[model samples]
Structures are given as C-alpha cells and as structure tokens.
Target: MAITSDDVRHLAELSNLSVTEEEIEPLKKDLGAIVEYISQLDELNTEGVEPTYQCFEMENVWREDEITEFEAKRKDLLNLAPESTDNQIKVPKVL
Candidate 1:
C-alpha cells in the first residue's frame, strides 16, 4: 500500500485542500505509513468471535406522554412580546 505524489494530489483535490509542491512528498509518505499500519489488522484472528455492535448494554426506557399546564396565561405571554397579533408573537420576515 504505497501512496504516490499523484495520489496525494488527487486526495487533496477531493478533500478541497490546497497542497503546495513541497507538501506533496511529505503527505504521500505520511498517508502511505497510515495505510500500512491499518493493513496490519488483517493478521488478527477472530474466527469464532461474535460481532458486537455496541460496547455497553442499551435499552429503550420510555415513559407515557402527558400534557402539563404552565402557570403563565396566553395573554400574559403575548403581552411580554414587543408586538403580537392573534395571540401569537410577531417576528420580522426573514426574506
């Protein structure tokens, strides 16, 4: 798994990075080393091991949905706003 200057250039272009001529060689060497190190995982033996999706136990803890009333009235909330119409807060148009 050797990385070349062309490969580095192409990767830079794909990632929207600006790479100079001096940086291409260094990037190629670093990327090649990373690929070689990652390829070492092929030597691991996991013949009878079960694939685990999560490291810890997870369960859905759900509660019943209930509506609770607030102490403030609708008119009180509307009055807090600088400008309101039809019991709704008025805001400036975005566009």
Candidate 2:
C-alpha cells in the first residue's frame, strides 16, 4: 500500500504528534514499507494449525492468607502526630 503525505498528517493528528514538513515524506516512505512488509503475511498457509492462547505452560499459584500483628500501639502512634483530637488526626479543611 502506498502511503501519502495526507495519510501521514492524518496519522500524526490521530497519534497527537506534530510532524514537520521535512519529516512528512520520510514518514510516508517508512510507513508504506512497513505496511508492505506486513502484507506479505497474507501469503502464509496455516490450514491445520491449532490456535494458541499462551506460548508457555503457566498456572496461578495460590497460598493460604495469614494475619500478623505489629508491636506499635495505637496510643503511641496517636501521640506522634502533630495535631490530634478525639483519637483522630486534625488537619486544615480542604474544599
């Protein structure tokens, strides 16, 4: 497929990119070559091939959940705060 300057400009706009005047021609040629190279895949013959979801053998490994306790106490943590009221941290109001 032949890629034109207009096609490049449209692609640039879709991709949120700003393309200069000098870059347009080079982009057009490069994009055209890429499309042509990918088009060659149409000639492949895969009549009896099975569809593959993953290339490797993989499975989800699960472990039992366990609860752990920390040494820090709630009162000690509250005392470290700069400002606290009614066992809760106090901060300036935000809209």
Considering every candidate listed, which one attains the maximal lDDT? 1
TM-score (C-alpha) between model 1 and the true structure: 0.48
Please give the RMSD to the true structure for each candidate, in Å. 9.8, 10.6
Clash counts for all predictions: 0, 0
Q: Give one digit per residue, the lDDT tens place, for model 1 in 1-95.
A: 89999999999999999999999988999999999999998899989999997787866778779888889998998999999999888999979
Off by over 4 Å in 2: 46-95
User: How far in Å is the alpha carbon of 54 misplaced in model 2?
Assistant: 5.6
Native-to-model Cα distance after best TM-score fit, residue 8 in candidate 1, in Å:
0.5
lDDT of 2 at 35: 96
User: Model 2: per-residue lDDT, tens digit, 10-41?
Assistant: 99999999989999998999999999999998
Off by over 4 Å in 1: 46-95
TM-score (all chains, Cα) for each model: 0.48, 0.49
> What lDDT would each prediction earn against the true structure?
0.92, 0.91
Superposition-based RMSD of candidate 2 using all C-alpha atoms, in angstroms: 10.6
Q: Alpha-carbon error at 5 in model 1, in Å?
A: 0.7
